[model samples]
Target: MMKKFSLLVAAFFIACSAYSQYDIVIVGGTPGGIMTAIAAAKQGKTSVLLERTSHIGGLPANGLGATDIATRGATTGLFSEFVNRVKQHYIQKYGAESKQVQDCSDGFHFEPSVGEMVLEQMLAEQKSKVTVLKMRQFDSESQNISMRNDRIEKIRILNRESNKIEEYTGKIFVDATYEGDLGAAANVPFRLGREGKDEFNEVGAGRVYKYWGGTEGEGSTFQTDNAVQSYNYRLCLTNNPAIRLEVKKPLKYNRDEYVSMIEDVWTGRHTGVQMLQVTEAMLEENRKHIAKGNVSKIPGDVWGIARITNMVKLPNDKTDANNQHMAFISTDLPEENWPWPTSSWAWRDTYAQRLKDYIQGLIWFAQNDKELPEHFRKAAKEWGFAKDEYTDNGNFPRQVYVREGRRFEGMYFFTANDATAVAPGKRPVIHTSSVTASHYALDSHAVRKREPGKVHLDGFLSYPSAVYTVPFGVMVPKVVDNLLIPVPVSGSHIGFSTLRMEPCWMALGQAAGVAASLAIDDQVKVKYINGEKLQKILLGQKATLIYYRDVNPADANFEMVQQLGLRGYLPDWEARLNDAIDQQTAMAWEKLSGKKLSYEAGKTTRSEVLKSIYTNTAPDNRNASSH
Candidate 1:
């Protein structure tokens, strides 16, 4: 009897040793999570970020290098601060040839490895204010989050390393994971699907087809049919000559498995056609600018693309087309992601393996296959995968493509009406809420081909809404008081794409942190937090609270100068704004701050302004004091 009692006690101790907690716990150390931790620390809150992998960057560290930065409007406060830090890394490494300063105007391209370093540095700066626990997950034995009356009272977490269980009590919790695992563990009210047009009175909201570029057959149809947004991993290819890494076949390789999709390639209906067109467009644009005597990189042998490039160009130039395209038409990993984004380790792991295989196979195709042009084939070969980034996995990064998942059905759902066009009586909102304003067309891809030679495409509508407001209610959970999701996964599918830029994500993360801080300080529910009060806090922090339409002070182009009162990319509206805003124009406007400029007034050339900002002589306006 004594021996049996001793065995029971031992088992109980082992079981209890599986969970632990902190004041504010964040899951998934992606950029959003990093920003959240930094925001919490800046607000003087106790926070801990738990990462399932050793690396911090979700996809940027692995292969996603593009950062979707919509609107060239100057964003101050936390978002600006983050960009400044990223700028600093380029200065330290490349000095005179740094790409950071030149990359951002109407937003610029970025390399993935460089991005990983930038994020890690940002987190390290806030070391004292935040605690980061890498390589941790909530297993069955460790999955325990207790909430009391809409507040998280106690969170017991299992320390996998030391085999110990601990409890943490907090006033607020944030789910920053690309996959809303924490929200699932807490049983938050969430959703995943396209709301039929009948549900929201939206025309392009349901299944339809309207092609762009061409159809799947003609490379012209941008269609849709009850499809969630597409998802894809970003590949950071290089032709740097010095970096020559051989492409390896995925362990799960079976060439026969890709026959149908591969057949698309032979039949000239390959997805690579659109990719080539997009790439060629960029290369041609670069050439056109160079011909005009604007300083630009020559259309190089190698081209880089990312996850967000398909629909929106991230501030960094990534794409989300990995899973959006079906079979060989996209990244071909939707089936793999079916079980993913869940809290179940088994499901997550299986999906993880599939992503690895998919990405690897894609790379192999880009290198050895006849699908890609010869120039691209040679250029893509010179680039080597970064070693320092994505330390969590030997092959890929930590972030999986989370197109649409666990959208918390909050107090207010931002519908197409609110997003398509400004609704009547909707005032220029001033809220503690921080979300991105999207000017791009409401875009979605077709899931299935509608005809034998046609594809299902719809929602490529250009009717854009006014600068939509992302309310705090969108981030706040309806049932879970302490939790908030700011990655724009908080809103509907149409809304998420608009809000899914890196800068916007940064803005929302900071806003969420501020809201969390308030919930902790005032001891109030996130739902009940005063919007007016939140607006004050945001303005005080230099966040854009109201999207005022006053002629911004930054539109001083040479053509615009001649047409003072006129509103367009240029004063004359003669120049059709193309690919990217010009560097020379950007430089001049930065110094002018929207004031009318006479070409003769001041000899501050683009070179001079570049020198000033790059040399640190320009006044740094991203600091807290400026806010």
Candidate 2:
């Protein structure tokens, strides 16, 4: 009996020591997470992607088919590849000259299922090096993270379905969730909601509206530290009756909640029409079809035209519906999403159900309500949840659109100044060796007040800005050594509003994966990895580290010029002809391009300097690979 007891003890110890290990462990299978795992796998690193839900491609796969990108040139690396594949998917299904192919030329919009299929195919291509575990939730409270000094050695996960705890060990960990769950679990310093204007001297910081449906006279622009933007589910709707699932009245449907919105539209306080011209064209098409006595065949484009937030048209008569800026009819649920960042899974699910109920109730009210305009009612009735999309979740989106979440307080905090290029003469803080380039306006959904119809547009800034580089420091936490946060990055709320797009997140994820692989190779902290070496790797992988519309990659010294541009050595002096290149700038340019330039006032023309720089840095063997 004693010998048997000793053997049992030894077996238990052996089992405990055999926790599953990988080169990298990614928590939260958002687009960023999926891209991170894929990027790491491409580098021959064994990786594990643990997703909380059955789906993998978060918002893009769920319902956000309309890619909200500022410019196509701004995208690079895996994101560019993904968009290209999406375009090819349409081109192959439809002829190259079809409208589907033409529309997807600049913007790649597809059905939610297609997004999932593409992501699955991409992962399958790297299945040997990547392990994806769906329905695995990260237990922040009970799970243990084995920490050796500042680095995390292992992470504990609680399976949501099995109710079993499992441990995963990895050399580097990435928190790619929109919520920054892994970073929160690791006890890294992070910020929830907006910051005070004084904190980062941000022009767009603070709460703007104090009352809903009230004029600016009744609102204030005071900074509130706890005001977070709204959250919603990007509904995938289709007009085809064959695959359209009628919007059923949710169990907790409440008519009183939608009374204010209906009244706003009825009183003309809020226009029932959409803000974009696409909706108008669709409406005209519907009118023409009706005049021809073919109302039934009036096309699905006429449906969901009233909601301008994101009424993006997709292939196969499907649409991706998102929140509009309407007074109360928008999908954004104010004051309800505040607890989502730190809430327990049970609480989150409850909140998610409430949002679904609210949205469903709104749809039902718009379609069936006698008080609404007849045309609006008809349009609403034409659309329903796409039966083929998100079939596992009752044809609803599997993931709610989390616009913003816990932003890490990392090595560098990007601010609104960095977003809008207000300082340094229309130049945002440039991290020349950036992994991603973002050029979106600082856009935030309405943050309504306690009043049902009241909302503040404090976070909306629509001014166009120059493309800004997302620095590697934003991914590396200041205190945490091994973790990388690509989605809920280290940026101010206004800054995040610009970087929060799915494409940029995927780009950052790719960068994080490369940085992690390099860190593991060198056995150094993420911050300690050589920036130039990492940049070289990213550039080699076709990642865009600098933004120069005039400079083409096919140029002789394009690589060197880009490298110099990233380091802030190459300034657009022609655009700022009145301002001369400083001595420091000239020295750095010479050092990088190996060309000396005259710093004397009015001595060098911009074109001459550029030509000289390119000639000096051009490769000795022109036939050699640029990479």
Candidate 3:
């Protein structure tokens, strides 16, 4: 049966063979792959983008309404081009300047079909240079990888769907998938889950801590520590009331598992937590929790869905269909995501379907079930499914949330020191410094139960952090010699908290593609590539390579930001400069970015309000990931 299946797979690729050879072969139709293909094409390299799924743009097009771009400068290269296309698409669809905030830039948040259209447009722009293969699974056994000394000679992709296998030789290959499958097949050493302090001699390991949202990694409490942040699907909910999208039940669904998780959440067990620490206290506390494996949070909070809090608004409007947002309160299908990174396609699909069912079940329970009250029903009802969010699959997103995965042990290991703002002159000087700046503190999930006896879930944590530089070396591996990681699973188990943002991944993907192209053209290994040359290339492409240390906070741009929109956030430069960035403020960026301000001079905050509303000392917990 296995042999027959193999032959059938071979037959599939043979029948649907599209392109035979190319300069690059990128597996996984993830955003990272899409961005890499775009970058490679723009660099005049012939590339083949093969994805297991039919659509592209990954999560942003799937269900994540908000895309996380750390900084204005990080939005350059192919990533910038994609954003530009989104702007143009939005303008064409919604009239001129209809969605633009006072900041003069149009916001992201367009329909999912529009997101696909934008990617398709990008592919069209580089038509001759790139070929996209959908529903094609790569088979390493058939590829016959011939390596001389250290470089890869050729790789063949067997299209299981069409029964056609295509072989191509290339000087470089990028493992752009969320799961570093290609890298693993190529014998790369990667780390999954948390890398305790003992592994890297760092302080933020082996324990669970709470990091707040706001500033850059600041205001964190010792709520829980030493746990990886949970994962879930970003539901594209709308309160439009005009459209009626039914919440369907998932197959093989069991309410018991969720019921338990949510039960723990109601008791403030494991819901509210940051992917990264935001505050010094939260970091410390998270360390303790990691040691104990008893992370907890509030179940009833809306942020309980998926604990992501930092959300920066883009040039587009909050209402734009393609616009991306981040938050602490989200529908995180935690139990569903555990198997995806290592699962086979069949398993992954089954897991995703289960996750969809879980989310649908949660929504249905919230709306129809008697457990929720009048206020909860009204609030949830206000949020419905988007009419044009996910165009490929029931307008439901096709991408799964990949919070953390394989971290390649690269030439340069990005440690806690690299992510810390106080590292002084230890900043890594990379050939290409992407425009994004990550501020969220090192954070992880707090495994708890749901509230109201509905489902066990809890989420929220205000951690402390400062904007840190992302080294180019983090993306490239050390021993494997050629592969580059372009998505959430880039480098640093703990540091992935901040770098995992969609914009950051796309930024890295664009840079990795550019680097691969350079390596091919200049005949240099990824590690040996000239930093100055790479930096020049990146800067030329408008990626913020330098920290712009000389650009005063009082510059015209700063003043313009103040005068136009985001009045509340105008003081962020001063507030965050001396302190760490928190999660709440970061999440606020998703809905407000350049247009609306997230803070006021003096307003008793939400966390504080909640604390005052319900005060209790959390029992001490030790983290297992701690040193």
Q: List per-candidate RMSD values in Å.
A: 12.1, 6.9, 15.5
Per-candidate TM equals 0.69, 0.84, 0.69
lDDT by residue (tens digit), candidate 2, 132-179: 998888856625677778788888887878988888888999999888
Q: Which has the greatest TM-score?
A: 2
Q: Model 3 residue 406 lDDT?
A: 61
Tens digit per residue, CA lDDT, model 3, 1-627? 999999999998876553465677777777678778877877898887877677777777665544544445434455666766777765665567564332225434444555667777777777798888787775433244655666666666667777676565566777777766677667667766555556665444433333223232232222323234455665565445565465655565565543443322223333223333234454455445433534332222232222222222322322322211232223554444655555566777777776667667666654544443334344445444565556547756676666665667665566655555554443332212322334445544432322342111332222334555566777776666666677634456556666666666776777778878877788777776655455446655555433333233234332222121111332223322223335665455434333333433235353332222122322112210010
Summarize candidate 1's per-residue lDDT along 1-627 as a digit string, tens digits: 999999999988766633233447776677777777887777788788877766677665655544544344423446666556666655665563544445532223445566677778888888886788876765422257776676666665566677676565556777777667677677776666566666666545555443343322343322323355444565443333444335588888755544354333222332322443444456566555534534334321213222112322222332222333322344544433444444477676676677668667766665566643444444445444444334445534556656555566666666556555434534223222433333334545433322344432333222344454556666677777778777635566665656555566666777777777777777877776655455446656656533434323233332122122111113221232222345567655555454333342244453343333333432222211111
Q: Candidate 1: what lDDT?
A: 0.53
Worst 10 residues of 3 by lDDT: 618-627
Local distance difference test, each candidate: 0.53, 0.73, 0.53
- Give the higher-TM-score candidate: 2 or 3: 2
Which model scores highest in lDDT?
Answer: 2
TM-score of 2: 0.84
